[model samples]
Target: MKQLRVKVTNAVGLHARPAAVFVGEAGRFASQIRVRNATRNTPWVDAKSILSVLTLGVEPQHEIEIMADGPDDTRAAEALQQLIASDFAGKI
Candidate 1:
C-alpha cells in the first residue's frame, strides 16, 4: 500500500463537486484507493466511488489520509495528493 496526506484547502472542502472530481481521478488507476480523516477510526470512502467520497464529510483545513493498493498505487497516491494540494486548481 502507498499513502499520502492531503489537506482540504477549498472553502467548501470536499463538497459534491470536488469530491466528484477526486472520484473521477481515482478511477483512472487500477489501484484500490481510500480516504479517511486522521482523527477517524475508519476510512471515509472507496476513493473510486463518488458517492463514497461525498460521504467523507471533509471540511476546510481537515487533513485526510489517502491509501492505495495495486500496480498503480504510487501514481494514484500522487494524483490524489496533487488534487488536494492544488485545491482542484487547474482541473476545476
Candidate 2:
C-alpha cells in the first residue's frame, strides 16, 4: 500500500476534463486506487470514478490524499501524484 498528499493545481481543480484524465490514468493500473480530501468526514472514492471525484468539489490548492494497494500500488500512487502536481495540465 502507498499514500501521498497532493494539491489540485488545475485552474478549475478536478473538474470534468481533469477528472476524466485522472480516471483514465487510474484505470490503467492493476492496483486499487482511491482519492479523497483530507477533511476527515469525506469518504475515499474510487480513482476511476469521475462522478465521485466531482463530488469532491476540489478547488485550487485543495489538498487530497491518494491511496493505493496492490502489485502496482507504487506506480499508481506516483502517477496520481504527478497528475495532481501537474494541475492535470497535459494529461487533461
Scored by CA lDDT, what does every candidate get?
A: 0.85, 0.87
Question: lDDT tens digits, residues 1-92, model 1?
Answer: 89998788887888788888888999999999988876454565799887777777788888899999999999999988998899897676
lDDT of 2 by residue, 1-92 (tens): 99999877778888889889988999999999999977544789998899998888887878889999999999999999997797675766
Q: What is the lDDT of residue 49 in candidate 1?
A: 80
| Model 1 spans > 4 angstroms off | 39-44
TM-score for each candidate, following the candidate numbering = 0.90, 0.92
Tell me the spans in candidate 2 whose CA falls farther than 4 Å from its real position. Answer: 39-41
Error of 1 at 86 (Å): 0.5
- What local lDDT score does residue 77 receive in model 1, on the 0 to 100 scale? 95
Residue 83 error, candidate 1, Å: 1.0
Scored by Cα lDDT, where does model 1 land?
0.85
TM-score attained by model 1:
0.90
Judged by lDDT, which candidate is best? 2
Best by TM-score: 2
